[model samples]
Target chain A: MEFRDAWAIASKDLRIELRSRILTNQIAPYTLLILVLFGFALDADTQTLRDTGPGLFWVAVLLIALLAIQRAVKIEDDDAAKERMLLTPVHSSSVFLGKAIALFIQLFVLEILLFFVMLALFDLSVEDPLLICVSAVLATIGVASSGTLYGVIAAGVGVRETLLPILLLPVLAPIAIGATRTFGDAFGRVDADGWAWFGLLSVFAVVYTVLGMLAYGQLMEDA
Target chain B: MNDVIDLQEAVVTLGQFPALTGVTLKVSQGEIVTVCGPNGAGKSTLLRLCAGLLPLREGSAHILGEDLQKNRRIIRQDVGLLGHRSGLYDDLTVEENVAFWGQMVRAESNEINEAIKLLGLDGRLRKVLVRQLSAGQRRRTSLAGLVVQRPLLWLLDEPHAALDSDGRDLVDGLIHEAAASGATIVLASHAPKDISSPSGRFVTLAGGRVTNDINNDGSGDGVS
Candidate 1:
């Protein structure tokens, strides 16, 4: 697969997202609202909230990742755009990579915002900055790869709206656990086994990316 | 000359319904073929099959000498399809939509501009978003993208659907031009009379089967 073809697809998606401002105007605000709602629901002391902020941050990430995938898939919903991409000479794996990359970048930006929001809202402090950054990057890759794979899988199904969450949530459980635990280790709220959790997140990201590249062609046939 | 499309008793089933029930047809290089039928008569299915969009359920199907069942991915590069949908992103301007597909095919910038000129969208209209354009304008943008690809085979399903008289004339001209340049054309339409090319062949499909096949020379055969 030509890297240029993949870049073309990724650039096109990113440009569309930038022009529409859908992620910033709608999804990002919704994610922040989730963080605010969690704060209200916790209604705990600063120490308790700080201890729990890492877990809540990941919860918000998982939910917002769903919206990101949905928007990515919806861009192809009109005018048989997905078929147009599939019909190109470029390998189907490249198309999958391009979409996964785009979603990763969007989620990356969202995570940065959420990280700052968590810092302010819960009075949290990063004890291990490097571990937090690495964990967030690895975890975002994991979510984007798996989310894109399942997004296309469900895109053509009749029950796609219901099917996407059903297919994605179970698969995302591992990433959620690994990310939250890694964050805990970074913030010194738990024993420093940050490397082990980061390793798990990396494994999830690599496995899902390879799986998506291998399965994309077959999925296009049915999608 | 090599056969651009060769399907022998091709069967395509959509769920419980058979969209194409054993359709056998052949078209050589540089031939303009028109497929006309009612809504459920599978006119669109035949074009899609040629474009490698639909799976062949039974019988042999080959496009550009590549087996449809096995080499679908390879066959797709040699074919361009213009279906019911315009395939243009509403958020993208006319130029961006055309350039995106042009880049996909790696067409040169000049070639892309030439295609846009053919569709008469090279001026102020090119900067307008697709959602803001009229249906005919969107269709023109879709055609421009297809033109940039310059595939060996063109599968046009209702290419004249949302066009005005001038745009319809443009579609006819494009078909002839593409065919003259050795590109095989298979156009599906409910109203075949609008396509008035003298050198074209007409194949009438009914209930997913070809009922009549007529050549430009007026010689014809009935398919059972």
Candidate 2:
């Protein structure tokens, strides 16, 4: 029942997102624009661009994930859909899982697109393709779980737009640093143990995922 | 007779302002109770409290035999609340919104389809997104969603607002039908005469308290 409820909520959110085209027309374009602007800022300095590619890639993903989280929050807040859901038999943890699943799907897809863009614009190539894939998977989960949790926390506040970044970015520093280091190793730019950083990303994903499930019920009631 | 709602001197504060102050009301099963009041008279707050969405700072509330102070969350599944907003997702089609909400309570496919048709949303409007719907259409869709829940207690706030005459009549009919089927309804409306039937009772609110409660049929005390 819990799994079904989670899927129902996730499907509803994904359907709304697809129909609205906010991710495609607005968020996706905006993310690509950030990368394009970065490309221009670097002035075609191939070595510098290649060296900083991993950091820039994760940075873009983190920034874009914020937009995606805000969009997720708005879909519920608008029209009082959240209140209606509160009246349903669905568990609050199910709601959190559903939202996190939707965010995971979206961020994973966005990361794929950003990866290709990094390859093309930054002239970056993958040496350990397996490491890159694993890093992206783990990092996306970590971001989506943590982002969905923080998104709802900020949503209850009147000044959500300004509050989300202030609350989220600091918490996501580990994902930023860990993903960047792992990606740098995957890109053969750094001579570090990528699996060691991958372990950190894995732990972050599990911790936040569990925390979100436990804390969501209380947070949703307050929200 | 089973008491569906037994609230006594319930005080609910939103931030600093007291929204519901000393509101004592009781509603029995299969009763159609209409709450009437001006703005800020605590009508909506009363409905929300009955729906188990608010905590009482003072006094007591028991809905569907569950003490709200002990467990307001558990009673929510059996309670349906249709607030000022339709609670419909704007980007979703009418059919999608109704079906999604219906599925939340595990409403059968037949129940969902029946609700959509009953609300007059089965044909062209079914595919139209709620954002594109007129106010009346959205209200009808919202009503359909509520009906699909098949809740024990219906908490409707301004259920007739933005509805056309036919839509209003449809809601009135639904409320009567729900009451006849043993469902308790506590609806708050400014225009009470339109929604409350001859047998329904009217409970007036003023300054966060019940000013008067009388049966429209002028027979028994409103509680019974």
Candidate 3:
């Protein structure tokens, strides 16, 4: 019930992550690697590549975020941090918030890395800065809530490294599709139904956020 | 004797296997009861159910006169739980490790400081990571966390697995301290211990049911 309870968990995680920079640094190059690979697969077709580039770029970004998120999920168990956190009287909802925030920041950073990489790779232009940023933020939230929940689940029973992605991507596909279409609207210079996908991704983020908060205590209970 | 931890037909089941069947148990405010059994003897299950970590499939449990499901958080606030695993983060220093949990439970800084001293961790508080410490030291941090907050009930599983003679004594002392405060202690271990002078009730189980329920008569609690 403490106002700063969630921040307590969040600050601890952020502090530890800052102390060991390996966790975030690994994502930056991984984003670049995926972009380079995407370029090779697309080849030199300006017309086809540009039309699909926006969609593929976001897909690459989402995948990179997912990768980083999976690692973030395991942070608790890496050093028995999860159990230590559970022992506290802080509500489980706060724990979920702390973890979701950590992953959200990591995902946002990954998306930023993708934005720069896309500009360099294909001379990408930001058609609407506001819309692109909005879509990216929503997409990251959608990924962070769902990814952190599954990460907690996996951390309890299985090897989180393999289980996090498998559990998150399928559940988060709607976010990706929504992000793809929204980003495409910005790049294609049209505003057709972009708000629809925006609405959909927003709903996903809220639903998962609530689900993660309410269920984490139960998760800790059995595990 | 005023009952501190009393179970009334506490039946907890997991899928097809009945974990705790028609089990009746009682421990006074200053009593120490050790539940010993085989691997699948439901020792851990009973402790977990009491800790509100496991659900009661049938019957009910009352901790300090509070229902588990309806008042789980209140009970959790007053209970200290330590499972078979040390559950210590290997990367953080000992001070951070204890502080993190203490901060969550809102333990006073002075209480945490006293726990650190009692556990003999003041010298290596900031320098040693859990991974760098011996098993005994790692367990000691966990003990410190358990003692930092003054809980009315203590539910522990395999607490002395990695502890040395001195470490065991440390735990034994903490158990006595908690009981002197009218806290109920339920410990699950595989071996016998010589820490307390109270009436140590022995509950032995097999196939997830009480096989004998006897007092410290050395004949095993006649729980069968």
Q: Show model 2 residue runs off by greater than 4 Å.
A: B219-224
DockQ of each: 0.74, 0.87, 0.45
Best by lDDT: 2
lDDT of 2 by residue, B1-224 (tens): 99999988899999999998898888999999999989999999898888877778999999999999998888998999989988889999999999999989899999999999999999899899999999989989998999999999999999989988889889999999999999999999998888757678899899898888988877544431
Output per-candidate TM-scores for chain A, rounded to 2 decimals: 0.97, 0.98, 0.90
Q: Report the error of model 1 at residue B51, Å.
A: 1.1
Q: Encode model 2's per-residue lDDT on A1-223: one tens digit a residue.
A: 3989999999999999999999999889888998998888999898999998899989999999999999999999999999898899898889999999999999898888888988999888889999999989999999999999999999899999899999999999999999999999999998889999999999999999999999998898888
Better of 1 and 2 by DockQ: 2
Residue A212 of model 2, lDDT score = 97
* Model 1: pairs clashing at backbone N, Cα or C within 3 Å: none
Q: Look at candidate 2 and tell me the lDDT of residue B82.
A: 89
Report the C-alpha displacement of residue A17, candidate 3, in angstroms.
3.9
Candidate 1 local lDDT, residue A196: 94
Compared with the true structure, what per-residue lDDT tens digits does model 3 show for residues A1-223?
4548877766766666665665567767777888787787878556556667677777776677666666665566665556545545788898888878877876687677777777678666777777888887888888888877877777776676676677777887898788888877877644566767888888998999999899988786655
lDDT of 1: 0.90
